[model samples]
Structure formats: structure tokens, C-alpha cells
Target chain A: MSGPYGTMAEKVLMKGNEAIAEAAILAGCRHYFGYPITPQTEVAAYMAKRMPKIGGTFLQAESEIAAINMVMGVASTGRRTMTSSSSPGISLKAEGLSYLAGCDLPALVVNVERGGPGLGGIQPSQSDYFQATRGAAHGDFRMIVLAPASVQEMADLTMHGFDLADKYRMTSMILADGTMGQMMEPVSLEAPEVKTYDKSWAVTGTDCKRPHNIVNSLYLVPEDLERTNFERYERYRTIEENEVMYEEFMMEDAEICIAAFGVAARVSKNAIMAARAEGIKVGMIRPITLWPFPKAAFKKAAEHVNTFVSVELSMGQMIEDVRLATECARPVVLCNRAGGMIPSPEEVLQRIKEVNGGMTK
Target chain B: MTTQILIAGFGGQGVLFSGKFLAYKAMMEEREVSWLPSYGPEMRGGTANCSVIVSDAPVGSPIVTKPDVLIAMNLPSLDKYENAVAPGGIIIVDSTLIARKVERTDVAVYYIPATQMASDEGITTLANMIILGKLIRVCDAVSNDNLEAALKKVVSARRADMLDLNKKAIELGFNYAD
Candidate 1:
């Protein structure tokens, strides 16, 4: 597909995590602090190999907590910075993520997820679905989660995550999986056009002519913190209005609507095709942006579709959102395979056939 | 339309390189494509697989569970994924390592002596490339011209001196019959 700029014929082979790292560097990210983890180690490794070449900063942090705090430290100075990890590592960074959100700092966090509740399998898994979408940390904050199903999206979304973080003054996550992190794809190395940010609010060193700016999350006064919370909530509201993205397929006259995202979407696509071939009216709803949840799109389809099947690699985590989105307008059934296992298209097709025979809800 | 494929084998079998070449060909043809390798602990001793999806439309997901085609370079890969190929799909096997034959009759299976062919062609590393050549010829998943262009782009940038050997291996596999 042609990038937003123009049609460039150049192509290079890159892994998904490596592509995200390259995209971040091209997007003006000057500092990156990360701890190594399975599936996502390539992002840190790529940064380690290339950061010095471009005079950028790369640090192998002691832990994910330290890494995320380091990102906040660099970002508070108005310098673009990022950190990345896998599912369990992200759980460790949750405390720092909450602080970043409370402080309203703009930074990027890439989660190349693996199966998990604890130290789950090292294979690709969407078990972190609730952790990413519902805020695994404490507080009233919400994160902007961008789910990329391909290597190109992995690169593009990394750049977009940084931009959105800056625009909304919050943390944004590229919620990818091991499948995406480890995959190699052809990517164009063309750099995106750089845009400067307004650093007037940044706490750069006191060498500036203006008064010193303080970046902090500590608000001793409850009312002041409440105002800050309300402001952040308003920004999130704006994001919900303008940034929700989803892909629809054959939903116009479908009786069964399958909802999935990321790797599940690929399997569901094949299942939908197979089901259609068997004369079943099955379609798919894939949410590209997992944070906003694409409620309107699901609600619109639920009006006509009799069965909404939520297909995922997790045990019914995203199914909650599907149910909420459909508003109980239709029966939402869950078909999932967790712990590093991906659901096959035939399994999904079987579910569609069963649902077609009044075996639902 | 798009074709999603998974090519898998041992670490030193050039499985990843074969997948990369196919993805490169798709990109050169101006198609939307993605190639993903098996990450995490699987890179240790277990089988290694790379998923390559080449499509005319914007590819929504890069992971391939039910691939339209599969290229199995080892016995384990064939055992694991032989049944996953779609009906009327294509399965290209390296008979050099895989002793047992596939049981599925719904898909077309071609058992090529890729390792022996590459050895006969005087280059052992070209086995995967040879299999890729067969894939392009039988499935037409990618055109010969696009494959050659992609091979030039990848090999010239890294192994310029070995271009002749790689081309010869590709031709041997492309021309292999039955």
C-alpha cells in the first residue's frame, strides 16, 4: 500500500519489532530505555545496534519499571523517548505507566505480547487484552492502544503512537504480539516527514530565557488533581471521537458476525471465507485500534446480525467489549484458545455452524 | 487476492531466507506483503517457521494459521502443518530429510529432493531457494520475473559473488518435473 506521502518503490526486509524501532528512530525518538524480553528482544537489540550510529540514546534497563521511568525522565524534557517489553514485563511496568498517565507525559510503550497471566508461554498470545485495554494499573487513566496485525502496521503504528501520545499528552502503546514482533516483512525505509512539538511545557534545563517549568505527578491538593483528571478524561473523549479504527468484511447481509483482532483476525478471516463457501452468511469485524473498542461499528452490525462470535487467543477477555458494544442486541459467543495456541479456521467454522443451528447465547 | 504461506525447517535450513525472498517478490510486484519469523524460545532448538502473506489488498493480519500453501523443509514441519493446508492447496516437501509421506489427498503434494539437488548444483545453502523456485513455478504464488528481481535485490546487497550459484539453484528447482 502507498504510504501517506507518495508511492515509493523501495523495499527492505525487517522484523516487526525491528521495524518499530526503525520507525521510532525515524520519527525523531532520541532516547529509548528498555529491558529485554522474549519476542520483543529484537526491538531493544535493534536499538542497541543502531542508536549509537545515529547519536541516539539506548539503555538496557535493570528492569521494566526502571525502563518506563527512564522514558518518563527523558520525555519530561520534551525529547521523544520510548520503551518496550512483552506481556509479563509490561505487567512490571504498570506502576510506571500509571505514573506516566498521572503526570500526563507523552511517551510510547511497545508491548510485543506473549501468552500470559503470569509467566505464560513465550509464543504469541492476546491474553494481555484486558491489561492493555482496561488499564492494568491503578487509577482513572486510559491508554491509547494501537494493535498492528502486520509488520507494516507495526512500523506505522509505532510512529503513530508517538504522535498520538504527544497530541493527547498521555502514554500510547503499540499492542503487538510475538507473531508480529518476530515476523520479517518487506518495508520501505523512507523516513516520515518530521513534525516539531511545542516544548513550552517541557522542563528543559534552566538555560532557557523563560521561567523554569516543573514536570510532576504530585498534586497535594485533591481539587487540583481532580481538575487534571477531568482534563485527561476530556482528551480521551476526543480521542474516542476521532481515532477509532476498524475493518469490516461482508457484514452488509450477514447473519453471523465474527469479532476479532490481531492474529485472531487472520484466522477469523479464513473461517469467514470457509463458512461463506459452505453457504453460511458469516462476516468479520476487526478492530485495528483496541482502545476505543469500535463500539459503534459493532452496534451497527449487531442490529442486523443474529449471532456475534468473539474469536480470540485469550479466554474471553475482549468478549466483554463485544458484549458491551452490542448492548445485548445480539447473542455474543466466545471461541478462544489460550496459552500460546491459536484457534484454527475450522474450529471457528464449526462454531458458526453450531450457532447457525440455534446453539447460541 | 492474496496467498499466505508458512515455510518451516531447522535453524540452518534457510527456511527464513526462503520466506523472505517470497515476501520481497510480492513487494517488488507492488503487492501488500508481510513476512514474520518464529520468535521467542522456538528459535532455540524447536522448529522455526516464517509466515509470509502476499496480497493485492491491504493485509489485515500477517499470522497464517491455515495457509494457502506450505513448504516443509523437515519431517517435523510436514507432520505439524501438512493437515493445515487448504483443500486444493499446495505442499512442497524436501524429500531429502522428510522420510514419511503426507496423508492428505485434498492438496497437491510435490516431494522434491531439494537438498540433494542443491548439493548436485554445487551449493548446499541453495536448498531453500530451490524450494522457493518450485513454489513459484507450481503455485504461481509469485512470478519468475518478480522472484528473480527479488533475488537480485537481496543477494546482490549481501552476497554479490554468490549470485551465479543462487540463480543456477533457482533454475534447477524451477525446472524440476514431477
Candidate 2:
């Protein structure tokens, strides 16, 4: 991080949205199709300017649905492709996303979420937790979801997200919020190493040299459909077992644990350190990947503490995952702010104090 | 040392740019830094603000609920953030625009007539840079030389013509801060 932020990974100041776009370029994502939306519009704007320079396609699709369908088209040819949108826009693309997942196509979908159920507000919100983590469309499938806390992680996770998608031949998402999307920080980006996947399965022109690769979700036979689903599920299990990513902060012998992710986790760290200053045995468990929730981290917390707090921007959406992860053995409490309001560190500290008082009593 | 600063003003007044300048200066010195803006609806022709953190250690949260330095470029900004400055922190105000006095006695307050000075230089847009001059001079967050170097990097080639005036503005505030 020191020395000149130049050459061999020169550091540059970039916002989270623009960083994601830059990382996409570095990760060999040459095709970009997205509609502009508040908070996340910078990603598309960045792509529009840079994509053409690098011999890439940067199409501003007519709509979110068109954008994702374009993603499907580009991904079919086996080149790295991506689309980005906000909450409401993401909802529209859900159908296209399902089609991509169903066809076993690898592509990147970025959701820099805003307040919503309707058009709610343009401020930051994690209300889309259920939409992003659980299946967004009709059917049973999960995309590889990476939650980035900082602008740096916004870039880092994007690079890794594309890799994971191609490795598993499944769609991957960079689930970010309005806060991280707009914030600026210094980030170092490196070109992705040559990691080629055997894309013999792509619907590229066979030229009659080999059998045609048919990419479709339709397996007319019920048995074949069920087998395809089970096979996908098998891959999901491997992802759950191996692709789980999380971070621990001051959890050793912590009397109280706060489980959160993304911006909430960033805010929680401020409170955790403040609580430690007051001699409160508080720690944090930050889930880096939301889908494969780090159940083991919660289990680790369960071994040390009986009280767990879920800090989030939504009304206890992620708290359910914490409860299930910890098996309801511990009292899982919630500290949240809905409708784009962010909780101050003092407020989080008050919650920690309340939980600590109950423990002492 | 850790300097948590909040710079606030109108959206077109270079509020975020001022914060970015401070952040880049810190980055040049190899100090840990973060710059987070108040985005969304609030950024459109309304009050815009950004939080900047420069620390010897890695930054914990880019969001600053209570900043050690509050730089107010307008009266509305002063009204919104005057009391939020931590006790014993510094409050730098643009005296030409904001007429209200900060009533807090625990914090150090400096009133720099940045707008008047920039207008005197015939470039009203550089008011933010003028106030920025007083900030680094007072806080020593970054050396004047490094701040000047960072200024060179931040002002893009499109507006390369304004660099000298910006330097003059910085020197004016630097002399006026103490």
C-alpha cells in the first residue's frame, strides 16, 4: 500500500461503481450491457467510456430486461459479459437472470441496491437481501453472491466474481449498496491471470467440425430435467462448502457478537471498536459472501457467546440467516434502519450496551 | 495522527472535490485515507458534503458520524454541522458567505473569507480551494508543499489554466488561517 501507487499495480482513486467497471475490464469482461440507474449509473457510464477503447461492447440497453437478455446473448458466445442495475431494475432483470442460470451460462450481474419494494427512495438500503440471497425468480437456484464492504472490495470481489462464475458456469452477483457504490477510495487492480475454462459447451459456431452445442433450459423429459436440477444442486453444495467467505473482528472471548455484512458491517466495526474501548466484550462477524452465509462463523460465535445481534439496513432480513446459522440456541437480536436511514455508531453501541446489560443481569 | 474531516457546501461549489483534494494529499504521504460522499438525491443542486479520514492506521469506517474537523463553505453547512464537530476539534467556516458565529467554546474556529478572496482573484469557483488552504495551514494535516502537489494532480487538464489562481487562493488562506 506504501510507495508510489504506480506500476505493477499502481494505485488509483476510484468510486465503488467505477471500480467495479474497471475491475470488469481487468477480468477480461469485454462486453457490457446495462441501463443507467441512480447510485449505480456510474458503472454503466464508466463502461460506456472505457469499453470501446479496449475493443469491447458497451451497449446502453433500452431497458433492464433488454440489458440482461443481451447479457444472455453475449454469454452464449462464451465471452465475459455483464449487466448492472439498481433494486427495481434488478427485479425486471430477474426473469433474464433465471433464464441465464437455467441455461447454465456464466455472466456477472451487479446490484448496487437502493431503497425499495416500490420505488421507495434513492438512498442506500439492504431490503433486497431476500431478493439477492434467496432466489429472485421462480424456481430453486442461487447465484454466487459477493458482498463488498469497501470501494477496494468492490473492485476485488468483481474480479473474483467473474472467475467464480466461469469456474462453476453459473451467474454471479456483486451485491453492493448505494453507500459503497458512491464512496471513493484508493484501490490497486491487477490484470487477471490467464485462467481458461474449457468452454467447449458454448453455443459457438461448430462449423460442422463437431456436434452443435445447444444452450437451453428445456429438458422436455421430466427425468432429465430433474437430473439437471440435482446436478446443479450438487454444484451449489460444493459452493456452499468451499466458497463461503467471511471476516472476523475481535471475536476471541467476545461476550457479545454482531453479525452483519457490507456497509452495515463497516458501520458495525466502528461500534465494535468503540465498545471495546469501554471494556465491552463485543466482536463482529462480517459475511463477505452472502449466499453461502458463513454458518461456521456463527457457530464459532455460539461457542463463546449466548447473545448475537444482527445489524442491518433492512428490518431484520439477514437476522434469519444468523438465527438459522446459530440454530436459535442464542438470543439473536436485531438493530436495523429501514427506508435508507443509516444507524450511527452510537446507536449500535447502545444496542450492544442493552445486550450486555441483559447478560450481566 | 488521525484527522477526520467533513467538507460541506452547495453541490456546484466543489464540496466533494475539496474533500478529494485532502484525501489525495494524504494518499501522497502514504497515510491511510478514505473519501465518502453524501450522494443520491441530496447531490443534485442541493447541499452536498463528503467525509474524509486520514489516519496512520487503516480506516475503520468511511462514514464519519462525528468529524474532528468541520469545513463549512456556506451558512446551511455551518448550521447543519457546527455542533457535530467533536470537542476540541476545528471548525473552518467561509466567513464571506456564512455570517453566523459558531457558539461552541470547546472547539477551535476559523472564519476564512474564501468567497470574497476568490472573487477578488476574479475566480469565484476556487473558493473551495481557498478555504482548503486555510484548513491544511491550520491543521497541518498535510504540508503546504504536498497540498500544492496534490492540487496539481486534482485540477484536470481541461481547467489547467486555473492552477495559478488556485495556488494564490491557497496562499491567501494559508496566511489568513492563523
Candidate 3:
């Protein structure tokens, strides 16, 4: 963090996309392959500018699929690689994602999501919740989804994503929305201590030193594929037990809880504060990890709160996770906006008030 | 206290740049700040806007719903966001472009012909800086100290010549009365 970028502790104003790019470099990511898409194009642009300067490769692939395959190529060689795209582009990368999971390759895929279902709009959204958590493509695999709520987390999580991807030998996705990708805030570029893993299994040149390392997802034997699936799930279980991250705001002695992440979580924080000011016992459990879903946090909050309001930019995409996490022990209601519209603090505050009224009645 | 400011105008008018200046000024002062610009097709000669928040505590939502201060550089921006300003907030209109007067009486309004002034001053592209200067003069959104340093950061190295003109335009707006 300190070298080359100089004065790493000094805060600099940066867009969320720029932060991600710079952090990726700090994390030793030398290969970036991405195609342009709205609301997330800055990420590619930033890489195109910085990667060359850092002696890294920033290739603008012909398509999203091509870009993801390029990522796979670098990942097979055991080098840090990344690709970023928006909603539609991410959909195109689905097959590649499943392939990576099948090959057990570690890589970073950033989804600066815009409204979706099909080229929805160039505005912020969380509609890809199911797509991200359920392993975007047709497969019995999982990608560690990190939901960053701020520009700072955008940078922090980019570095963390690289580490986690290497650690679990699986793809770690930074599931950010348009707002989190576009907004600017003061961030410290102070490099974090990066952790490296052994890449003995990488497809490096054998040079007649040993057997050539092969990387492939196709398993001709059904039993071999089944065993690999079981092993991947075992890794996922360890991740679920260890990598769940969340923040609790004003949950102490609270009767109402809000479950949100990314921009929705930020908006919910404002509402929780306003509701608290008005003497309402409202709090929030902001999940930093979406795939693992922070089930423990929700289950614990369900024990104390009367109702859980799920705020999101999409039409309650994350609500299903909230209900399942809490095991339907408490009522989970939706406060959301769709088609790229974001919920205002006042809207969420009103929902909190309504939920409080229902509880009282 | 948190000050939520929104800047709106056509794409070429530096609406996002003005927000960046304010955000950088606040950041230099060690305050929590965020700047969010409208992106997508809007940047290709369409309406562009930016949301900036300066807060004592960490910023929550980067989107400004009810702005404490509104800078309207064009008619559509004024018409669309006039009613969205918080009561007792401040509204600065670029009289050179926006023809109509703000109908809201709850918020204080300042009509600075920034576009006209910048034209007169031979710095037509810097009307955004002029309005920013007026914002600093009228309200303590950000202090004028380190203004040059902030401008230095935002205005790229290639366009360093605009630095002095930008400063002059801001001074013109800062000194304007009535």
C-alpha cells in the first residue's frame, strides 16, 4: 500500500470503480480481462489505464465470455486475475463462472450491477441476488459473494476477494451495485497485508521437472464429478462457518430489525437512525457477505426483533434469504424499489413506523 | 450535522466537477464526504447531476433525496428539483440559463448569472466553479481555505492553465452581492 502509490495513509477522493482497480493492483492482480458495460465501465477504464503502468495485462476481450475465459486462462497459471461487468454482461459470463468453479480455479469477478432481468436500465439495483448467491450458471457450486456498501469497502473487499479466492481455491465475487461502483469517497490506499497460497497445482511449464499440471472442468466419469461437487460443498461449509461478515447497528434492546446490504444497507442505516430519533426501537443487520447470507446474524436478530424489514433496490430479491436465514421465526417484510430506483430514507422510515404499528396492534 | 447538496445542469457544464470540488474541500478538512455523479447516456450532452454530502458523521446514503442546497444550472434541473429542496435550504440558480424564478418561499434563493459572468470573464466553461464559490460564501458547506489545492487535484495536469481562470471565476461569484 505504501510503495509507488506514496503517502498511502493520506486520503484521496476516488470513485468506487477506481478504488477497486487500484486495490486489485495492490493485491498483486496482474491480469484484468473485461468488456465494457454501463455503470461499470469505469472499472474497465481504470484498469486499462493503470494495468499498463504497473506492468500488468489489461485486455479488453471481445465479449463477456471471452473476458471470463481470459480470466480462467490466467487463473490456471496461478496468477491473480479479475474481470468486471454489469448485469447483462454478467449474465454472459455465467457459463464461464460455472467452468471456473468446476475447474476449482481461484479468481475475482466484480459485478457492478445495474437494474436487470434483461438490459433493465443503467441504474443501481440488487436484482442479481439470487443469481450471485445461487452460483450464476447451471451448477452445484458456489462463489463467495462479498457485498460492499461503500467506496471504502469497494476497495477493501476487492483485496479481500483476491485473498479469499486463493484461500478457498474458488471464485470470490464482489457483488456491488451501480451506486457502490459509481460513487466517490475518501479512501486510504494503504496496502493491506496480502496473503498468498501455494500454487503447486497450477498449470505452469513442467520443463521436464515433473508431470504437467492439467486444468479442466469436464469430468467424463460421473463419480469423479460427484466427488468434486462434494469437495466443493465441503469448502463452502468451511467458508460459511468462517467467512460470514456483518455489522449490527443499534440492535441492542431492539424490537424491529432491518436486513439490508450494499446501497440498501446504507439507506437502511439512515432510516434506522431516523426511526431511533423518533423513539422507535429499530436497528439493522447489514450483511457484508451475501452468499453465506449471514444466517447467524439474522437468526440472532430474529430472537430479539418483532419484525425484519428487508430493504433492497430490487423487488425484494434478498428477502427470500432473510426469511430462510431466520428460518421464518420472525416476519420478514419487504421495503424495496425496482427497475433501478432506490428506496429513500423517508420511505424506509415509514416502513419501519408501519412495522412498529403492526407489532403494537 | 449533514449537508446534502445537489448540482444539476447539462453535461458540458461541469456539474460533476463542481461536486468533486466541494467533496474534496470537505475531505481536506477531515470531514466525511461523498460525491456521486449521474452517469450513462446523460453524459453525452444530456442533463447531468451530482449528489454531494458533507457530514459530521459517516455518510449513510450517497444519493441526495431532499437536498439541503440545490444548484440549478438549467431550466429542467430547476423545474425538476425545485420542490425537492429541504425547507430553509439554499437554492442557487444560474440566471443565465434558467429563466424562471424559484416558486418556493421556504428556502433561500440566490440567482447568480454564473454562465453570463463566466462568459463576460472569458471563462465560460467554469460557471460551475463560480456557483461553487457562491455556495461557499452563502453557506459554510465548505471553507474557502485549500480551495486552490482542491482545484489542483480535480483539474487534471493537462488543463493546468484553467487553474487561474477558475480561481478568478470563483472570486467573482464569492464577491457578488445582491
Candidate 4:
């Protein structure tokens, strides 16, 4: 496929996890800290092998917690940085995620999701849906979550995530699954246009031009902490207004709507096609940005659709948002498979038929 | 038309390398392609598989539950993935390692002695390339010119010295397919 520049024909075979690492480097990310875990170890392995070749720093940290903290440390210095892990490891980084939020640091965290409430299977799962969108960390901060269904998006979103993080002065996550991380796809490697940041707020040593910048999460006074929380909420409000991304297919005169993201969205696409073949009016709504949630798009589709089916690799995590977005105008149903198993196209089609039948009655 | 494939086998059996070759060939043809490997615990003593998808359009999903073709390098791979090939798909088996024949008649199955051919060519590591050559011939998924270009590109940086042996292995496999 032709790249953005259209100068060079672009095609390089890359695994999804490896593409994330490559994209980070291409986006001028100078530091990467991560722990080894199933499905997502390639992100670290790629960085370990390639970072030094490009004069970047790659650290195999002690744990996911330490890894995220290391990312925060480097990010506070106005350098692009990233950390990645699977489900359980992401849970370990939750506390650090809150710290990043409180301090308003720009960093990228990747969760190559595996099945989990706990130490789940090493296969792909969308179980982290709630954790990613609902702020796995404590407090009222919101994150920018990008869900990539293909390896190319895995690379593209990584670069974009860094930019968004810097733009919003908040952490951004590429919420993928084991399937994405393990799968290989054709990806083009191009350096993104370098973006410079205002490092006046960064904790670099004080020079003659400016006083020292303090990077801390501790606003000890209750009112001071509350003000910071409200400020962050205001930022999230701005993000929601501007950054919601969604893809709509065949929704023009649809009776039933299928809502999904990441791998589930891929399967849902096949199911939507099959349902259409069967003369069922089925369409799909795919959220590219999960945290912004694409509520407006869902609300728009709800005006016409009779039923909305949420397809995911997890049981029912994303359904709540669908219900909220659609305002219960339509019956929201879920078709899911968890513990590392992916939902089949047949399963999704079956649910669509069931929902279609219910709507007619 | 584009096809997504998974080639699986035991470690050191060249399953991943076969997928890489297919991906490279597709890329040389200027087609969209990807090659994903089975990592983590599966890489040690367990079955290893790599997913390769070649498409004209932007590939929406890289994960393939029902592959258009499967190249099974061992008995385990055959047993595991034989049922997963789509109807009217193709299955390539290594006769030297896989003992059982595929029971499904709906899909075409081609048995090649890839390891034996590679040994005959005095390059044991080229077994994967041998199967890849056969895949190109039977599937005709990519053109011969594209395959040559792909082989050159993949081998150019890492295995430049062994390009001649690899090329010979590919030609032998392509010629022996009759």
C-alpha cells in the first residue's frame, strides 16, 4: 500500500508486538522500560535488540510496576517513553498509571491483553476492556485508549499514541490482545514527523533562563488535590469532545447493530457480511478510540437500530458503555468468549439472528 | 484475491521461516502481507506456528481461524490444523515427518519430502524454503518473478553468503513438484 508520503512503496512483514516497538522508535521514543510476559514479550525483545542500535535506552525492569515507574521517570524529563505488558502485568502497573495521571505526564503504556481477572491464559482476550477504559488506576482520571485490530494499526497507533500523549499531557494506551501481538502483518516503517515539546515543565536541571521544574504527584492539601483532579477532568472533557474515533459500516438502514473493537471487531465484520448475505439488516460500529468511547456515534445509530449486540473476547465488560451510550433506546446484548478464546463469526451471526428475531416480535 | 495461511511444525523444523518466505514473496509483489509467529510457551518443545496473510486490500484481521492454506511440517501440525483449513482450501504436508494422510477430501493436499530434498541439496536448513517453493507452485499465490525477488530481499542482508544454496533449493523444489 502507498504510505502517507506516497514516495516509497511500503511493505515490511512485522509482528504486531514488534511493530509497536518499531513504531515507538520511529516516533522518536528514546526510552522503553518493560517486563517480560507472554504474548507481549516481543515488544521488549524488539526494543532490546534494536534500541541500542539507534542510541535509545531499553531497560528490562524488575516488574511491571517498576517498568511503568521508569516510564514516568523518563517521561517527566520530556523524552518520549513507553512500557508494555500483558493483562496481569498491566494490573501491576495500575498504581503507577494513577501517578502518571496525577502528575500529568505524557507516556505510552501498552496492554497486550490476555484472558484475565487474575493470571489468565496467554492467549488473546478483551477482558481488559473495563480496566483500560474505566481507569484501572484509582481516582477520576481518564486515559486515551486506542484499540488496534491489525498489525499495521499496532504500529500506527503506537506512534499516534505518543503524539496524543504529548498533546494531551496524559498517558495513552494501545489496548491490544495476544492475537494482535502474536500475529504478523505487512507494515511500512516510516519515521513520523518529529514533534518537539515545551520542556519548561520538565524536571531538567534549572538553567539561567528558567527556574527548576518540580515533577510530583503530591498535592498534600485536600483543596489543592481536588483542584488538580478537576483540572484533569477538564482535560478529559476536551479529549472526549475532539478525539472520539469510530468506524461505521452498513448502518444506513440497519435493524440490528453490532458494536465491537480490536479483534472482536474483525470477527464482527465477517459476521456482519454473513448476516447481510442472509438478508438480515445488520451493521457494525467499530471504536478505534475506546476511552473516548464513541458515544456520539452509538447514540446516532441507536435512533434507527432496534438492537445492539456487543461482541468481545471477554464476557461483558464493554456492554456497560454501550448501554450508557445508546441510552437504553435499544436492547443491548453481549456475545462473548473469554479465557483466551476468540469469538467466532458464526457465534456473532447467531446472536445477530437472535437479536433480529427478538426485535421483530 | 488474497489468502491467509498458517504453517505449523515443531521447533527447528522451519515452520516460521516458511511463513516468512511467503510473506516476503507477497511483499515483493507489492501486495499487503504479514507474518505472525507463535511465541511464549509454545516456542519451547510445543507446536510452533506462524500466520501469513497476503491481501490486495488493507488486511482487517491478522488472526486466521480458518486459513486458506496450511503447510503442516509435522504430524502434530497436521493433526492440529488439518480441520481448520477452509473448504476448497489447500494443505501441504511433509511426507518425511507426517505419517498420517489427511482424511478430508474437500481440500487439496500435497505431500512433499521437503526435509529429504533439503538434505539432498546439502543444506539442511533450507527445508523451509523447499516447502515455500512448493507452496508457490501449487498455490500460485504469488508469481515466480515475485518469489525470486522476495528470496533475494530476505536473504540479502542476513544470509547473503548462502543465497546460491537457497536459490538451488527453491528451484529443486519447484522442479520436483511435477
Over A1-361, each residue of candidate 1 has an lDDT whose tens digit, in order, gives 4652256645677888999999999899979999988989989999999999999999999889999999989989888899999999999999999998988889999998888778888988898988999966999999999998767778888888888888888899998878878877666665777877677888877777678988888899999999999998898999999999888988989999999887788778878887888899999888989998899999999888999999988889888999999888889999999888878777988999999999786
By descending TM-score, how would the candidates be arranged? Answer: 3, 2, 4, 1
TM-score of chain A of each: 0.96, 0.97, 0.96, 0.96
lDDT of 3 by residue, B1-178 (tens): 8999999999999998889988988988878899999886875479999999999899999999899999999999999999999999999999999888899999999999999999988888999999888999998878877678988988898999988888887888998885
Best by lDDT: 3
Per-residue CA lDDT of model 2 for B1-178, tens digit only, reads 8789999988998989888888888888888788989985765469999999998877777888788999998888889898899999999999898988999999999988889988988888889988988898889677788455777778898988777877887788888834
Q: Candidates' lDDT values, in order?
A: 0.86, 0.89, 0.91, 0.85
> CAPRI verdict on model 3?
medium
Clashing pairs in 4: A184-B35, A184-B36, A185-B34, A186-B33, A186-B34
Candidate 2 chain B lowest-lDDT run of ten: B140-149
Q: How far is each candidate from the true structure, as Cα RMSD in Å? A: 2.9, 1.9, 2.3, 2.3
Candidate 4 segments whose C-alpha is farther than 4 A from its true place: A1-9, A359-361
For candidate 3, write residues A212-261 as lDDT tens digits: 88899999999999999998899999999999999999999889988899
Clashing pairs in 1: A183-B36, A183-B37, A184-B35, A184-B36
- DockQ metric, candidate 3: 0.63
Superposed by TM-score, candidate 3 places the C-alpha of residue A303 at a distance from the truth, in angstroms, of: 1.5
